[model samples]
Target: MHWISMIGIALAANLDNLGIGVSFGARSTRVPFISNLVIAILSMIAAYLSITLGMVISQYVPSNYANWGGGALIILIGIYAVISDYKSNSKIQNENGITSYIHSPNKADKDNNKVISWKESLTLGVALALNCVVGGFGAGVTGLSPIMTTLFIGLFSLLTVDIGVRAGQQIAKTLIGKWFNLLGGVLLICIGLYEMFV
Candidate 1:
């Protein structure tokens, strides 16, 4: 049960990192190990803090209400992700700096350096970590262990980014990269249901 939640949340949360990796690969940009590590650490820290917050909320609320509220929050996040991604597909919507970076990760590189340095990764990491904050809190309210979930998120973030970049053209050209947001949304919806019902 715990394993299911951990893995599901980890995979769902890191899909954006994978998409970022694909974008970088498409641009032939490299996220060096240190830079990737920096990103992963930020995500971990965000997840930890948000999860703690959710756990605190859970303490103040009835278990059933907590489950319903948290599950609804996760579902809403999933729906929002799906709708945002769909709109992104249908038209050229104007986005702010951080949002633009999320959709097109190449912008995060800034200096036109083929490599993402550790320093450059800080902002990018924060952008990525924001996605985890709410989701982590929702999962935390469902009683998933904060430490375990954070560890899983960090591991998956590291691995997904590396794998996406390494897979390069092959993955970029595939439907997976193109449909990443949808896949992530679907996964989150499932996890939300699990949290509420199981």
Candidate 2:
């Protein structure tokens, strides 16, 4: 429940938002305000749930084990993120004997007409929020305040996405295209590893 812990958890949880924002912003796509709000809300809910789950588990398990478990869970989530992103980025062969790939939210926005619809925003929000759940659970197990964590996460996510989008708009594509998710995943894994040992 320390303020420092809350801040750390929030920042670690939402780093991916910057990447998402940059991806969309680089294409001049606006993530509508409502969508941003929805994303915050969704992130809050997911974080709260994960923390609550941790608290419940804490009641049944020793505090030490709970901490280790939470840390392990977060590490697993980080690995999943990296693997999933790698899979998504790889080309797939379709029935037409052509290679294709899943679209990034920004690319989808562009394909759908250079504007990101509310629904699309919600979908993006959900996807982004997934990154927060594991870290939130770990923070909760280590005695962080779920409410404060959620509040910080929502606020940080909103701000990060906004900043990322703005930065994306200014940055070159070659730079932006590089490795946002990979970096975020590595950060999460490192944080989880730190938590596990400490």
The models' CA-based lDDT, in order, is 0.88, 0.72
Per candidate, the number of residue pairs that clash is 0, 0
lDDT of 2 by residue, 1-198 (tens): 356557766876776777777777777778777878888888899999998887777788887787677677767767876886687668552322101101355543635676666676666777777767777887777666788889999999889878877888665366654566666666667767766786
Off by over 4 Å in 1: none
TM-scores vs. true structure, each candidate: 0.95, 0.78
List candidate 2 stretches off by more than 4 Å: 2-5, 85-103, 107-113, 117-119
Candidate 2 lDDT: 0.72
Candidate 1 clash total?
Answer: 0
Task: Give all candidate RMSDs, comma-separated.
Answer: 1.2, 4.3
Worst 10 residues of 1 by lDDT: 93-102
- The superposed Cα distance between candidate 1 and the true structure at residue 44, in angstroms, equals 0.7
